[model samples]
Target: MTPITEVEGRRLPLSNLDKVLYPATGTTKGELLHYYAITAGVLLPHLHLRPVSFLRYPDGPDGQLFFTKNPPPGTPDWVMTAPVPRSDDPSARQVVIQDLPSLMWAANLVVEFHTPQWRSDAPAVADRLVFDLDPGSPATVVECCRVALRLRERLAEDGLVAYVKTSGAKGLHLLVPLVPTPSEEVSAYARRLAVEAEAELPSLVVHRMAKKLRPGKVFVDHSQNAAAKTTATPYTLRARRTPAVSTPVTWEEVEACTDPGQLVFLLEDVAPRVGMYGDLLAPLFDTRGAGSLP
Candidate 1:
């Protein structure tokens, strides 16, 4: 018989508890679940009312990976879902994890949690803008850090406060909170900023998506601000060889980062960091105080 666990009055049958999900570190599914449970206080706020897309590595990081926007077949009746109208299909529905039990249910199957810039209730409006600073081969997170610092300054000049985070891979992500604005406008503004950054730092920045142009430069990926695009949600574990989380970082940490390894945060480091820093990206939730696009 499958062992059942009760989380906040919701009974969930968890499978393969000891199954290794991060082969390099030997991190198991049980540990991943624990990480989600512990960080729920901070993680849930960002996910609240947002439709999530799951990146699943059922057999571990080395196995086949797939992306699913809709809830899986066995998803419980109590799990909340919201309709997301697609250009091809209007009846499509996506899972919304509004509470602890719902999070755990998703965590059991998902290695990475991805969400759009807008919430479920207002899918056409963006509440934040994001720039994914991806460093190319010879360049590393160190290069991304330099680019992020410069971008932060640029956003500041425009009266927008930007927050930095690790991508849980090799780069960094910078986010700017915004008052509700149309997704197209947000995407346009982000694109404009990317172009400006490329012009200002022609030697270090590339705004275009072509991989050939990325070597020795940080690609300022502003296309994630699009309505259909999604970013790896903060606090979500990446499906790398090891269990590193997409973690929020202080500008001080970003500034002090000299080695790429310094920005890599594992699952074990998150809860303690949350205890000490209490959600560095908390300001993103203040929708009323969010800055308007200039």
Candidate 2:
């Protein structure tokens, strides 16, 4: 049964409040909505006006998952959506999340994570460049961090700042803010940078997406920077057994950190951490000072 709840003055009908999304941690759907509500201050800015595609897990993370780009039929008109071109049909519009109310509405729909595009329409520019450092079976988040630190140094040499975050799984993400570069240009730069990083650190990084080659190296995935590709929005709880989050961390922590588990922020840890870090990647969304690549 579903129950209608009030969120930010909007009515949200949430089903299975006690339904366990993360069985190991017993985290419920209600808890997920609450987390989004509490972290909206830091999260909404990243989601505002950006196209979003959802990975819905109707039966929780342990069950089957499906991806949806359009607002399901019967969606309320109050929910904001954008009409982005579909890959198969350029004219066909795909719905996107644009505000907090829409965000909460998605949570109720069993959207496990809020993943948004890298660009926003008003600014009409690539807001950030992302590096998805995925570690293979033998390689872990700890190893991913080592690779992240190295990439950070390289980005510094390139005259850009990189922010670190856990991938909510066994990996790390390195995001760099850009000043309105074309999505294609940003994607090209990311790809070249990843390839360069792989070439420079062949022993530590893998540039390809093949699963077999990733066994003992960090996969420096640069493809997420493309125009329509999405990355997990910060502060969203991951669909993991323990309900881990894609959390932002400091470079200091990245260098000294050995156990990746310690850095796995939870839904409960966000508010206080944001209090301390004040949205470490928030500047990535600001395009007012958008400058050309240095």
Candidate 3:
């Protein structure tokens, strides 16, 4: 067992450093923590002011896993938590990630994935709209690129700028930074875009959420735009077989991606990619809406 360490003024009691999460890659818990530590600079900005939901793998990735909204018991008081009101009970408090130390604390819990809401606390406003492209089997990521390109064109017609990334699984995520829009307005706008996409490419894209109907097509899930709804934060590790990361990529790469593997980044790739792209999603954090069209 490795001893607990301090990071960003927070004490993290980390253990089981050698526990393997990705069976195929043999990626260990310590490696995961180190990855987060090294990439914290780029990753923290996206996580800042957002409530984070965790996908925990206690034993390992292949072992029993659970999703958690509240911080687990024994969470240090130093880990900043947001008192987000729950949907079922507006009075119920849901803890969200506040800073780098809090995020590192989550890494100690073996949080394999970090999913954050679209809005931040300082403004409690939605700064971006997300379009989640969930593809059913036989559709593949190649199909997602085709669909995303079409959606990008549609958004451009409305004078909106768009960016994209692999979901780090079987899909893709498209984001459009907005000028502090209401949650409902963002949701409505995303829904409208999804509908337009489906109407334009009936065979390639579908806006319906039903899994039964999504086969051979990309399901444009605009619902993630709603308050409290989350999409995996960029650079978050996916609890997949090979340690795939939710990575940001350029539209040119999306179009050039022949297979999803080309975009499936891992722990080692984080630094280089961050250096190359320099926080590709930074526009989402710019409240001035510099890139958004007037």
lDDT assessment of candidate 2: 0.77
Clashing pairs in 2: none
Candidate 3: where are CA atoms >4 Å away? 113-124, 290-294
- Winning candidate number (lDDT): 1
Off by over 4 Å in 1: none
| lDDT tens digits by residue: candidate 2, 44-97 | 777767766777876777888887777677788887666666668666544556
Q: How far out, in Å, is residue 112 in model 2?
A: 3.3
Q: What residue pairs are clashing in model 3?
A: none
Worst 10 residues of 3 by lDDT: 115-124
- Leading candidate by TM-score: 1
The ten-residue window of minimal lDDT in model 1 covers 104-113
Cα deviation of 289, candidate 2, in Å = 6.4
**Could you list the CA RMSD of all candidates, in the order they appear?**
0.9, 2.1, 2.0
